[model samples]
Target: MESTSPLFALRNVTKVFPGVRALDDVRLELYPGQVTALVGENGAGKSTLVKTMTGIYQPESGEIWYDGQQVTIRNPEDARQMGITAIHQETVLFDDMTVAENIFAGSYLTRGRFGNLDWKAMNRRAQEILHDIEAPLSPTAMLSGLSIGQKHMVAIARALSVDARVVILDEPTAALSHHEIHELYELVRRLKARGTAIMFITHKFDEIFAIADRYTVFRDGAFVGDGRIEDVTEPELVEMMVARSLNETYPKVEAPLGEEVFRAEGFSHPTEFADISFAVRKGEILGFYGLVGAGRTEIMRALIGLSEQARGEIYIEGQRVSVRSPADAVQAGLVYVPEERQQQGVMLDMPIYQNISLPQLHRTSRAGFLSTRNELAVARQYGERLNVKTSSWSELVNNLSGGNQQKVVIAKWLATHPRVIIMDEPTKGIDIGSKAAVHAFMSELVQQGLAVIMVSSELPEIMGMADRMIVMNEGRQVREFTRDEATAEAIVSAATGVRA
Candidate 1:
């Protein structure tokens, strides 16, 4: 069958920043009634291509064709005018506004003769859009009152309300549950049926096979592969994404666990979670498993001193420590890389060197005078060690790819030289190649006698890397398994409260 005419096409596109060519001679096509999966390793220019398509950045060279006609998308408003909309990985919602208000923030409906605002019409339309996405929400509901999943639904409703012909979803399911992902897939199918073209950007291979009809791979700011989903194996796609073989992606390491390095006893927090306890031995990796709301993250936060109402006895190196804040946790040799890297992990506006040295700034300074040379040395050492693909230490963190940004977060924590590292969803939303790199780094840390506690939602990841596994259900620990005992079935049964 002849391929359907592309609703949009980018030819010979090139985007350049001060010292970086984000995208070079990249070509992509989006067909109506089909979903295209955009795949690549971090700093491979996936985001840059998306930005160019969404009018966040203008290409230095090339043409964008929509409906077989050349078009100039100068701004986001222009893109929206042309029936294109983007739902970014990081949600952009007005927290204080109601769902309906946020849905029509920049463009609100107007009523009768007096030109008064049509609140009723707006609410009804918002409700209709939310219902179309299978989101259970009230138009009057406050954005601040919703969970991360709910907020994402609101964003989707807003996008649907625009009635866009081309929809771009950047890691939409990153923070959603399995159930919510199903709902999203249903909505996406509906959109496809209505002839909407979708550019689905994600690192989850399972999702690509499940939702995408076609695929495009990016490597080092260039197009590496493009074909139908059925024609590409997951391994082939991953290889194209990183431009390397999987066998060589991760480094080799073997850890020999020693005596207990840190312990949490009877940890509890009222709203977030309750009655959590775990221990990490030197040179060991303890994995935490649960659904999105299963208190895995809550317990991690409490253990890392990011929770205010948390009550627990934290023992580090056989000495009891009081950790009331992140600073306290760092003082106790406990470092946490938060889930939301952009918001909590790195300073997007700051240079890479500054962010890498943020946690250990005191170590690089004397008499209140910061030492640039020391900071540069530390940043360079860890940056290269972590394989952060950046042009220079002075490059802004935001300029790097999602995977590289994550590496910077890891680098920052490593600068502190912590005894115990708590990584919450460390590999979440990263490409397969980057995921393997992160896994290799975790193994290295364990071999170096650094106790690591990882909270992850991906079953395969937990099964592959964890030395020990702890499953949580409804705010309580349900089961523990050693590496040999841990399996996908066992972890799922324990996490879902189903007896095996």
Candidate 2:
């Protein structure tokens, strides 16, 4: 099997962007009737590779081979004509349009009577395609009422609208339920039996081991390795993606344990997560570790009242507190630093001082107006405390690097003087140096008797920084571990729902 070449392959692909060579002579192979798992860490050029395959971006120099022939795909239509299609996690589908209309949006079938759009014929074809794919969706039914999993079905139906040979699924199970995921696995098996090549892109190990025949790994924009799924273990795959061990970096300083500072009681979202509860003590780093769709971020959002309908009660220092909104959470001495720093963390266009003081304007204001002097003073203090390297307090956040920008966001929240700070994916998108700095700052924070809740996907980061850990799977708290008990093998198994 290793000696035989695949029908579709990308040879020596090189794509260069300004200040970054996204893909440096990368290679990928997709064979007919097999599922290939495309694995990588964040910013490892997985998305760039997908774009090149879909004709969304052309490689500066590379060869795309399909059906035993070299091909040139100048646009999306060209890719489609070559029997290539993709179904993204957030596929573009119109809610008001019928499933049939979405299936044949760009290339509508037309014939009969007045040579106009034959709705009847199109509906008939759509019904056939849906049925063929084992999708129990109505062709004439409106897409608005469909669930996320159903929308994925519609997306698959649209892909099968033509004679699709290669299908790319990018994180398609990120929002699906447990049952929906099972159904999706069955669909993948059916597709495999039909001789369709599949590229399954996800961060879940369980998905890869369950559905993939072969595995390809990319790290730092270069190909690491590829082999049959059964030949290697999960830890070996992780080692390929990380290219480093737990002891490579991360500075953690243990502080004396203190009393409880924050606690959650029975947190539940209607569709996201349920029955979630946890506690953080002063001078503690409580880490939440899970796979991409395990609802960790959703729980954080609900805690800060972003999900209005989510039911949850919170406590601070043994007293019940109201957290019905962001303001309420802050007022109760709790604050959240979101994972998406550019959008939810800081005001990118605003000056560093303004962005830092914006969240605490009420406290920094006098006579119903904010004083520029007070704002600058408040920003200067926290900025220096966090070691934020900026040209000046008046420097715009957009001008700073990703790490500095993250520091500015942390400074803004710290100015509010909260008891417990929730940092979601705190070091994401930053370099290793920046991550170490963040970890050092977290240690300093806990040493000051401030409770910190750090949510991260990196196993080493969680193990290095977390005094205690909770692993969630499919919207439920499946397991918990202390610093002494946390290990890469155990955490991955629990996060992937494998029985101990």
Q: Which has the greatest TM-score?
A: 1
Error of 1 at 369 (Å): 2.2
lDDT of 1 by residue, 2-86 (tens): 3479999999999998877889899999999999999887778988888888898989999899988999999999998898998
Give the alpha-carbon lDDT of every model: 0.88, 0.88
lDDT of 2 by residue, 390-462 (tens): 6689989987767788889889998898999999999875644457678989999999999999999878789
What lDDT would candidate 1 get against the real structure?
A: 0.88
Residue 195 displacement in candidate 2 (angstroms): 1.1
> What is the TM-score (0 to 1) of candidate 2?
0.74
TM-score of 1: 0.91
Q: Residue 33 deviation, candidate 2, in Å?
A: 0.8
Query: For model 2, what is the alpha-carbon lDDT of residue 374?
Result: 94
